[model samples]
Target: MAITSANQLELLQTAEAVAREKMIDPALVIEAMEESLARAAKSRYGAEMDIRVSIDRKTGRATFTRVRTVVEDDELENYQAEMTVDQAKQYLDDPKVGDTFVEEVPPVEMGRIAAQSAKQVILQKVREAERDKQYEEFKDRVGQILNVQVKREEYGNVIVDLNPGEGVLRRNEKIGRESYRPNDRIRVYIKDVRREQRGPQVFLSRTAPEFMAELFKMEVPEIYEGIIEIKAVARDPGSRAKIAVISYDGSIDPVGACVGMRGSRVQAVVNELQGEKIDIIPWNEDMPTFLVNALQPAEVSKVVFDEDAERIEVVVPEDQLSLAIGRRGQNVRLASQLTGLDIDILTEEEESKRRQAEFEERTKLFMDTLDLDEFFAQLLVSEGFTNLEEVAYVELDELLVIDGVDEDTANELQARARDYLEAQNAKAMERARELGVQDSLVEFEGLTPQMIEALAEDGVKSLEDFATCADWELAGGWTTVDGERTKDDGVLEPFDVSLEEAQNMIMTARVMLGWVDPAELEADAEEDAELEEEQEA
Candidate 1:
């Protein structure tokens, strides 16, 4: 292509301007123009066609040449080998397959069209490269702050110019209280980075949890040094936050370090948060105490855990209830997340009232026991002015349907009435004793006076006689007391003793007996008793 006149000059100027816009070198425009012309020539002319294209970047002059191929002795139209004498002379001398003959082909008036095509190629390649570069640069900055200038609003999203490129701030990402105009500078956190046809896009955020964490890291040196670890953080952005901190070293005070001298360090964080209040709590392994500290500025009386529910009931004094709960429950809500417990708050007055209700239930149970006793006494009289033996043998539930009696009432009455019969039985036993109940019938070891009296009525009169009887015949079990035993009437159970003491007692008794057979001993006792009777006669 040849730039022949005034029209060609204008195309070159436009190409330069576009190259500047796309950040491509101006000299590449000339190379692109030459390539385009070469292709156009080959398409316009066939196997006989030969063209050469070149351009002068400074003068915007472009030239194209067309010529016929030289063939050798072969009849082939296009030849790869040396040209024939006739063909080379017809075109030009010293022609070759890779060489071209020059002939002017640039349209005298359309040089500008050729330049425009080249400019388009340069612009497109430049844009694609720039897009790749932008993606790589912003990809690593996803959680970092980037300075942006407001451009214009398009389709409800604000376009921001980032010097080398542009980014969009969607309606949701832009903070409502903050506004921007053209050329206004603003700091935005890169929320996300995405690749698109035009370029790499960056999304920004003002409400991210990391935004607050980053702000604190910037303002507080202790956090950066790892002296204070933020164990947990919860925020109601723009208002308040509860952060749990633990010091790795025992010498450091985490809360004090965060708050600074005269509240300077934390105040800096507060200013960045637009005057939001921050409560820094020293974290603890004790869940109860940790929860109380998390809800600071509100005193807590107690924290009762419901382990199955993973919830805690916080008890605050009556005056501190509102403080613990905060405005609309914000304080407790944040504290719950900070301490990882679902909190249910109650005042002291409410807890006191609940305790009173439980106490009343226990009291009612005691009184019902007393009422059953009177009912049982009347039942016993109606059944018969029964002997003590008849009272003890009575089946309990058979008395439940007796007149106005219910299960609990009948049960209590039976127990109370049984006690009276047992006392009368004891007296009868004492009468048997006065009739000369043998000492053998009364000497059982560890037997209470009541158990001795009851046993004497059954003709078991002594420890020697009791020991000779089977355990089941006494209490029907191998335990110290028998199965017939009841709370209101039974032998007292043995007291606990050390193993050494028990072993000593058993050894002493065995040595004295010297392995005598129990059967022989019983027979001898009977014979001795008969001889005593004869002597008395």
Candidate 2:
């Protein structure tokens, strides 16, 4: 068949018809042809093959010629099998074994099968070349957005006609509320590029988290230039998103800078996201404060971090629970992902009950630590002293100056108070137990000796505190994790379960059914009490 530009165009039209009949693109056929020709040339002439061919504009006549290396070779068996001396003379000087020569090989049509085979080879080559070209074009644009025209829909997915080629914009990547028609212009972020048997495939997205980041870069100069840094982002895609941003320059307010004058900067991003709500939060090094800020519009009361579990528990108001959790848990989910914390949400009522129970548990512990022999802690209920906080916060001198107390008595009382406070602390461990806190101990930090005693004073005490206390307040009050104390220092290593979990096991063992009776325990306690009283007496 004749090959030329005019004929090629005619062939293109015919190929398009063929492609359409076969449910394929004519461009795909052309790519395959180019690839097949290159491969055939490479194989036939070796690295010395530099054959050049072009189709005539009107005739469709594809002229093929051979370009050969000027070298000497005798038996060119496998390479250029038919090289006449006259043909070899044109390209070479002194001919010998292993010498090279060039000769024009006429384009021969063996039969229809051979023609078909050549067409198939060309098609295959086109596909490979297209894949390589597409991979190169899109790999660098992985996280960037490109404007594309909607070409066609297949199996609910839209194929976008990009300038260089085409790409698939999966259904999931389509904005939830947006609809598209053929030829509609839309901006899509390049999610991935894959090389396939047919050609290079482009994957596009409209809902990825980086979509917002990319839009921000386009809208805000500060972002592209790296003046303002987007520390992290949490997105619900088509609904709402929270981004933590910080600026290296003190003069620039990161949030305001991103927001632009009257919300211009963020508005551009929101428009790209199809009216999605955007919340720009100021990033903080302080974990607690940052966590609270991240769960915005929900009014977080506190955040508790469990170092060993690498988790955070957020306390919010009862009404704000759903808001904090968001629809289908999007809020907390995004926040957890952004902060790299496993977040657990708690309501005010639950936190309140837990706080009360924790209070009672600590009081019982304080009572246990008192020197039952030399002294005893008398509950000062009449004076409104319910927990240790009332006691710890009160002036030591003032406490000693109370009626029935002198300076000597006061000093002794202070020492006793301190000891009682220390012993009440569940955080304290003997040298053997000093290794770690229990693995099941989620509220592993923030329980101060004073807080423990205070809780005890409130009639709150025991493992019940462990069971009921909200992680936030527990984390806020004191610390249980060991090692370095500063934020600048990296996180402490997790406490080993073998040593730490023993404390929880002991509590479990004591709570089982085979335990002694309270009355029997009271009688035994009375005997102990008698001994203590005698020692004091």
Separate clash counts for every candidate: 18, 43
* Shift of residue 196 alpha carbon in model 2, Å: 2.6
Kindly report which residue stretches of model 2 are placed more than 4 angstroms away from their true locations once superposed.
1-109, 317-323, 358-537
Instruction: Give the Å error, residue 245, model 2.
Output: 0.8
Candidate 1 positional error at 366, Å: 16
- Residues 1-537 of candidate 1 have per-residue lDDT tens digits of 445576557658866875677665555655555665665555555434556676666666666666544444665555532355655666676666445444566543225664576556655656665677678878998888766788987766778887677887877665445556788876667889899765688877755656666667777788888888888888776778888889998898998988999999889877766677889899998889899899899999988986533579999999999999999989998898687677889899998897666555444433343343444444544555233334345676666647776778666655755666567557756875864566544443444455556556666564444545443344322222431222222221222222333334333334344545657767877999999999999
Q: In model 1, which regions exceed 4 Å deviation?
A: 2-118, 147-159, 168-176, 285-287, 305-310, 349-537
Root-mean-square deviation of Cα positions for candidate 2 versus the true structure, in angstroms? 17.9
Predicted model with the maximum TM-score: 2
What TM-score, over all chains together, does every model reach?
A: 0.47, 0.53
lDDT of 1: 0.66
lDDT of 2 by residue, 277-366 (tens): 998998998877888888887899878887655678888888899999988988887787678777889987897898767655555544
